[model samples]
Target: MAPTGIVLLDTYLPTSDEIAAILPELIGDMFEPPDGIAHLEQLRLTAMGRYFRMFGDWNPNPVSAPKLFVRPGDPLREHHREVAWRAGWPLPHHSADVGGNHFTMMSEGAATTAEAISRWIDALRH
Candidate 1:
């Protein structure tokens, strides 16, 4: 699910010139000191051109509730947590701290993660 989100975000990012126009104020540190408004404008145009040509109006996912297979140490997990909190959810049904970086953790802990997800999926199936 999170991977899909990243893909979507990346897809939208290049085309989000309107959104990026405000990014300098929000993330002023992205540029070094003495950076001018032209830099920001350039960034907007670049992102708009990249994104506009990259993604379609819609994605191809079949389900609204996206499914993600991610390790606990993955940075995206934190983003997922933030989104869940912002949505006012009480808690996530399942998450585990599998040690390692993204690829390492996925390789080492795929079975455990799959088992955990299978449990939830099976419950829903019944």
Candidate 2:
């Protein structure tokens, strides 16, 4: 089923250079997966290799659907909101800034995120 609206929670749509810079770090993060996870390292390496191969030619297709960008107030990745706006993605009446960085936002700021989403959905239904 097609979604009526989308809630983007600190999503990253990286440029080629950004991908190149972060690819190694991403692979590093996948290392040392918990014990008993068979072939995890190989799987991560394979995926990273595939992503690297695709990065140079990557392009973000235009999205027509309404979107709500939930930005974290912490300042590291807040630029993502502007990126979405510049790409012409439609935003809700107000962009929500939950108080945590990208990773922590989901866990620490989950309530705020949920409330913002609920408000946006309620507004749409009205």
Candidate 3:
């Protein structure tokens, strides 16, 4: 289904280096490749390079869809909250505190995140 709303979870809008740093941790012993870890590393670097190059200089474009910024209760919450406010998303911009750090928000905080999403979607439906 097409997305009715957008939920950003502990998102940093990471730079190439930041994205690159997570590659090893994320891909460790996960996949087998002919070229080994070098392949994954190259892929990560290339993809992040292109992604940052394309969107790095860009700002949020105006859209009609609703946007929800979900920030964990962490040091970066205020930073992301500010970013969401300044993002100039659609008129019905919203924010929610999922009550965990970035990683935990995805794991331990999944239920809260899901509930927030459900509530947002229900509101949109109405």
C-alpha lDDT score of every prediction, in listed order: 0.38, 0.57, 0.58
Find the 10 residues in a row with the least total lDDT in model 3: 82-91
Worst 10-residue stretch by lDDT in candidate 2? 84-93
Candidate ranking under TM-score, highest first, comes to: 3, 2, 1
How many residue pairs clash in each candidate at the backbone level?
3, 0, 0
lDDT score at residue 118, model 3, on the 0-100 scale: 87
Q: Which candidate do you rate higher for lDDT, 1 or 3?
A: 3
Tens-digit per-residue lDDT, 1-126, candidate 2: 667777877544445333344444334445643222223466767875676576545655656666787776663234544432221123342466777654456776778888888999898789
8-119 per-residue lDDT for model 1 (tens digits):
1111232244334433433353344232223346776677456557653433444434343333443222443333211111122233344443333445656765665566
RMSD of 3: 8.2
Clashes of 1: 3
Model 3 agreement with the true structure over 60-109: per-residue lDDT tens digits: 66566678887666432344443332222223568877766555667777
TM-score of each: 0.30, 0.55, 0.55
Candidate 3 wrong stretches, greater than 4 Å: 1-3, 14-50, 76-92
